[model samples]
Target chain A: MLAVDMAGETVRAMNGSMVAYDGEMTFKRQGMTGGEGLRGALRRRVAGESMTLMEVTGQGTVYFASEATEVTLVELAGDTLLVESDSLLALDGRLQTGVQFIGLRGMGTGQGLATTKVEGQGTVAILSDGPAIALEVAPGTPLCVDPHAYVAHRGQLQQDVVTDVNWRTVLGQGSGESVQFRYQGHGLVYVQPAERGGILEI
Target chain B: MTSTTFNAATLPANDNVNPYAFSVDLNGQWFTQKGKMIAYYGQIRFQALSAGPLDMLVAESFHSPLYAHDWIVAEGQGKLLLADRGFDINSYDLDKGNLTIRAANLLAFEPGLELKQSIIPGFLTLIGTGRFVAASNGPVHFVEPPIRVDPQALLGWADCPSPCHHYDHGYVRGVLGAARMMFGVGGTSGEEHQFDFTGEGTVLIQSSEHVTSSDAMLRELEGQIGMLGVPGLRQLHGTIAQRLAAEQQH
Candidate 1:
């Protein structure tokens, strides 16, 4: 659960995620805008990366929670944060929510081919199955992350699918972790301790 | 509370990054269960136990053929992170000692420890030395027995004899008690049956009783059923039917 103290500012949160509030507050559905106008809404529908948000405006303090999932807040300073739609919980109303094509790497992980893009300045709350660990990806030290455990990534980084497939894979003796997200460059990647069940479980 | 970040240079070597995740400083090889690895930093390669070059290592340390498909060998150098369904991750060290643990809870074990199928179905025994990681639904509690534990809460036991099933059917004594037992009248306390442990050594139990379903255990049970003849199967069928009926009544 997260408590936000608002003197009079507004915050965009996941729809129906407000648990309780004190003082005065008004929640209005973000509607078709999808935080990127009609074009963004259409792109979301086509990409299957839609996220429903509600605008909460008013005063005092408000508590927000969703399914009791662990929440971690990421503050952005005119940079981009790419996250899964479902892992997005709440964000500052000023932050721009958009969509970006991440190619077919998300196909095997079952997270889809596009990712939710949060840019501009503000704090963004992302949900994870457990506490999220932030790993730094540098030029020399690249990181290999299981796609199922990936939550989000920020900064200038190159993401690619690394496959270690061999004859053993065809013999039903493949290492369960045959595909991983290889991240290089300079950035931070967030990963939960738990791996979500994916098509690769078989 | 999300400010702390770790790079390859700072990540702990063979320690936990958090209570729910473990970081193994991989220099050579480690045996891990399928789908337990979450992430890693540096150069590492994963291959099935049946992979060509690992045959000697697999034959030396891994003795459970039933679980061969579910096991893999992680080789190379790096920090390997592992977790299981967000369970509380913990590492146990055994120096020339043996420990038997529930199959589903055993996440990853080092190659130095020899793995074998326990005589008790659904459990695996690790002999020799080295370290292994396990997960529990909650924090694990260690208790010495001379005690009876709910089977669902049992995680593992070290230096102890295998437990036997103890059914305290004391309620079915008098005529009314017999009627209750026979007709399922008063219902059960759900605590009558437990794994009774004796002698020395420590028994590990989780704080919660939610047991993660083990496919390996189910397969083990299926294998044991082959030993039963037609008459035994018939008796087992009757018992399962009664259980189903009793479950539906609830």
Candidate 2:
């Protein structure tokens, strides 16, 4: 049994079957550019059926999630964490301020991101469900990746919404029309190794 | 009870109307017969409150905070959203003109209407007749049935002669007798439980202003014997009680 020290914070299941958290809990993560072989390159896509739980605490925030059949616990800041859910979230839980969860469907895309602020002296833990790779970007740097090829991250990351689509992307090659969840805060980000979507759903 | 009466035949008329209004207040029962929202404050028998103009009964409830929905009545058919889930639904006995539902789900109620312990279909949420209460608030106050109410929220007591603590009747006949009394409320009897609401019920609600986790809840019962005195302070006492229990052991 994992004890929640906080009242509300966002959390989602990760590869390690743990929950990762932040304030304005986000759905997208930033993947690294070049360098590592397919192992690091392929870590950009792959997330499975996930639900995020967050609670608020006087000490800041605590989060919990069921990982590859295991339960994970973590602490987070006011700026990280997001909520995204569809039919998966039943009424057994509650939702609080400063947290969010995003549910992604292969045939769907919408602006489900929320606004938030995270900062200063806070302890946070991110659980990688499978093997996850971390990528860091310095201030004033712009990093890009396939929309479906990344996990969670901190920093002033903005995903611009666009409707116009190119022929190749629209023809099932995956929508070439993409938006970016840009990062900017001075915090560590956790990204799972996968490309083109979560680990092959079996 | 004012002698104000309304005539159904002399009411307004309309066509192609399904939703409607049913009002029961101090004067009597009035039906707009063609609106989505309807409110009442007293007792009255309704002809029909359904798709033929569904029933929407909202009242101040002799209990609870804001407004509330009480019992709904139709001539031969009716449906009432008595509790929170589908499990608490009760089908109307058209021939008997009665709609029976459980009691516990009746958190708060309106005047003239009662919160009763009726037989609800068995489901995950129901056990034994799932307790409920029916009440009203217009000209007269009523405890529709013998309901098992929490001793807390008993504000001030009136009639009813018996000791306070276990089972006791209402103010129907007696005015004072030691019934199993719930503190702060009048009527039959209940336990020395704290009063929590602002309105009426099987137990009267105590008078309290705002409260957070840190504030004293049972603030008004400072001099009253058997009361926790203050809600927060009572909790503190519980902690102290545990400490005392431990100290004696050593």
The best candidate in terms of DockQ: 1
Per-residue lDDT of B188-211 in model 1, one digit per residue for the tens?
A: 788877999999999999999998
Mind giving the per-residue lDDT tens digits that candidate 2 earns over B1-250? 0011222222122110111111112232222111111111112223322222332332221221111122232122111111111111111112211232222222222223422222111101111211222221111122422333343222122222211344333432353433323233454233423222222223222222211121112221232335545786778788789889978997
- What TM-score would chain B of candidate 2 score versus the native chain B? 0.20
Residue A45, candidate 2: Cα error in Å is 29
Worst 10 residues of 2 chain A by lDDT: A86-95
Candidate 2: lDDT of B89? 17
In candidate 1 chain B, where is summed lDDT lowest over 10 consecutive residues?
B168-177
How good is model 1 by TM-score?
0.94
lDDT of 1 by residue, A11-103 (tens): 988889999999899999977876688898999999998789999999999999998889998989999999998998889989998999999
